[model samples]
Target: MSGPHAPAQREHGPLPFALPRVTATQRRRAAALLAALEAHYPDAHCELEYRNPHELLVATILSAQATDVGVNKATPALFAAFPTPADYAASSPEQIEAYIRSIGLFRNKARAIHAAMKDIAEKFGGRVPRTMDELLTLRGVARKTANVVLGNAFGINVGFVVDTHVERLAKRFGLAPADATVAMTERWLMALFPRDRWCDVSHMLIWHGRRACKARLPACADHPVCRGFGSTCELRISARASDTDRTKSNQKPGSASRAAKRR
Candidate 1:
């Protein structure tokens, strides 16, 4: 009934559900979860190291499908090689690729960075755009990247930044419904948490997910957050178990249910 580990919020919506309304109980749980996370990880902040907005933007772009650790490893030389938007714009994508070859999708990312930087240099006076709409116009700059840049580079909190960790933890914490899409999850997170705390909310949830509430083999046994917040662990475990059982059942040599036969 109370604490960070509260009952999962039951969802109710129309036949073809869009974003379901946040319940009063879920709101309470969200507040509690934020408090607990803050207490546990007082120093939670963005892991992507950058000295400037352009650097942060570049790091964020490179971070797609790659870990922050990986991006950080490859960014120093890249940042030094092309210190500004104009620098990146003047350089070819092949040149950019040379510096960031260690990252995943480096070729595509190099092209994206080149295009985005060219737009920034030519249109925006070599400065990173502060607004969401302007940021979205640049290549590789979606809502998530825009949110990260705006929130971190500037002090703007237009929306919550939903990454893979935030997406998974949002459901497991019941801050958002299990069936909620990423967009809907962002909407729900914005509704539950305070507007000003949106940036901090992103960092805390991400840190928590990385440290304890990992995707595979979570530290639900003895981790302080897991110990204190144990209610949703069962739900997540059950969900994963169900998925595993279904996969195994499908792969089994000879197992056919009436549902499979009927289909």
Candidate 2:
């Protein structure tokens, strides 16, 4: 994680364009993109299931390198066992590990969860802090996690949630450069979309990434918004090229003959 307020960067160079200098045409396209996504995913939202702020905070932390579905599978038993910040604070890291061992980075996550819960219990009076500054003080709570918790749990759209899905889709849509960092992408999105729709924009892009413009084999040929963009959709062009390359590879003399005989 970078500085609490700083955007996390990759090893690549800086973004091609400064965020503050976004053009009028780019803003119009961004608005159209958001509208299409809203029409596509009418009820797009945070897929992580949590009944309260604490649960959401923990789940977002757990979802670091894992899928939301995977986190959901573990949270029920974990949340049931330690239903409160004080309960989690009282439990040993090893005990917490037992419930969430199925998730990736369980040991470190267990430590973070235990330590964060302890902070909440002792420092925040057993409640999750509502502000970005305060939330960043919790273990494993970066801006991304802070945004997720603030936006979904508290209706505060402080910033966009730049998960892998959001990052990929943002680049695909040409909203940000391909080499842009999560923080840079978030900044571009924040500048492009309306403040009130910040949270929903993240959800909509995530939903599209999951359902249509996937990492591999994106449904670009028939995707409504993607088709509208047509040749300008870099992801669609890339997907088509990849499909062609795959077809060529599969048609190699021995491979095609063998597959035909098997069929």
Candidate 3:
């Protein structure tokens, strides 16, 4: 048994499967893939609902520990009650907290939103800043939220966003190595896809993660992009089987088996 152990490998260069340095051919493939995904999800956009940057900032804050659906439920009343940055700047934390009580960590989000609004109103003339540096100045506005607003709202693609779904799919798609951090993942994705497609890529990848490449179980059997990635497809196929078992348990006894046969 002691003979079964082997020496660890070492390297100062790329990971064994680090997405081959983006060649012109690879870029072309990426472009075609992007085109297909864009066509498939033409309507894909930021899930957070907001009429303006200020609302987007607030909604993104609310979305920290809550789903976009839940945040959407909370924002209509919040946006109506405080229609302007100045309104949020002047409002008490108690007022903002009341509107967003349904979201987790409302108290902290209330504090961040109130402070950020005051800063925006006083320093930026009651508007959310379009540039990365200025946007980063707002409380709770990190690269993820800033990228979201700048890309979707202002059409400025400073960099790619690395959200939970993006992170998961990035790994599952073999776009980045297993140990990739958010910043590293962003760099990897930006390198692979074209600059203009960065924002849309996040949306498409997120949609895929939600509908197919889920965290717990990915539906690789039906995912068109599975094989292009690599061994992750194997992981997804297994996860898909696990999903089938759970699904079968919830359905009429023979229904799932029948469906499998038909497929």
Candidate 4:
């Protein structure tokens, strides 16, 4: 597909699902969903612990395959060891690795942090860059990390942050195509909400994802937005049905018949 309404494609092929065309009604519903989410998580903000842009950038990179809690646990000691961009730039990968060994892929993460800090020190005067373009020039910094730093640290809402939770929630709420890539999902969210609310939208969705719309089993029955949508929460319903089927299939073949005979 190619045009104003063309679906975004991956390098290998077109996305598996197509996004529904936007309408005024859908926009209204989306707005209501955002409002409900905001109300639910009025104190929503970045969960990652960072005192500065450099810390946030490093934490986000380490968070690629790790949890925020794990990242937080590792950062305090790491930050104390290397308190500034210059400090990180000066440290060897081995020394940096010692501080963040508890995080997943700590070796690679250490290298990325070292390389990124080196770029910051040499290229940007030992300060994290404020713009998306400059941040992208650093090692291991993508749109998601740039958005995290720019939005939280610099107060610049360049785009949405489409982590796994945001991606899943976007599809479940019918806001983005089911098979949308992280990049496509971000674009979809940017279009769905106003520019001013872009940062909050990411935070709110993340908060809801962590609290209610969990991956394996979402608590949609109690969610205001899900209830307002008037569907049976398709993901939860399907997951429950699948679990029931699996349980039934795993039973002994003649167990039901034996139970009936005994009764």
Best by lDDT: 1
C-alpha local distance difference test of each model? 0.83, 0.82, 0.78, 0.80
From the highest TM-score down, the ranking of the candidates is 2, 4, 1, 3
* Clashes by residue pair, model 4: none
What candidate 4 gets wrong by more than 4 Å, as runs, is 1-21, 230-263
- Residue 225, model 3: lDDT of 67
Q: Candidate 2: deviation at residue 132, Å? A: 1.0
**RMSD to native, candidate 1:** 9.3
lDDT of 4 by residue, 214-259 (tens): 7867787777776776434555697899999997898899987888
**lDDT score of residue 45 within candidate 3:** 71
The list of candidate 2 runs beyond 4 A from truth reads 1-19, 230-263
lDDT of 2 by residue, 1-263 (tens): 10122222212223334555689998998888878887888877788888888998999999999999999999999999999999999999999999998999999999999999999999999999978889999999999999888777767766778988888877877888878888888888978987778877788888888887787777876888887654245545778999999998868678867888999
Residue 252 error for model 4, in Å? 18
- Residues 1-263 of candidate 1: C-alpha lDDT, one tens digit per residue: 11122122222222223334677887787788888999988877788988888888999999999999999899999989999999999999999999999999999999999999999999999999978889999999999999888777776777789999999888877677789989999988888887678888898899988988888888766677666656376566778999988888777565556448888
Residue-wise C-alpha lDDT for candidate 3, range 70-179, written one tens digit per residue = 99899899999999999999998888999999999999999999999999999999989978888899998898988877776666777787899889877866678889
lDDT for model 4 comes to 0.80
Task: For each candidate in turn, give its C-alpha RMSD to the true structure in angstroms.
Answer: 9.3, 7.7, 13.2, 8.7
Which run of 10 residues does model 3 get worst, by summed lDDT? 1-10
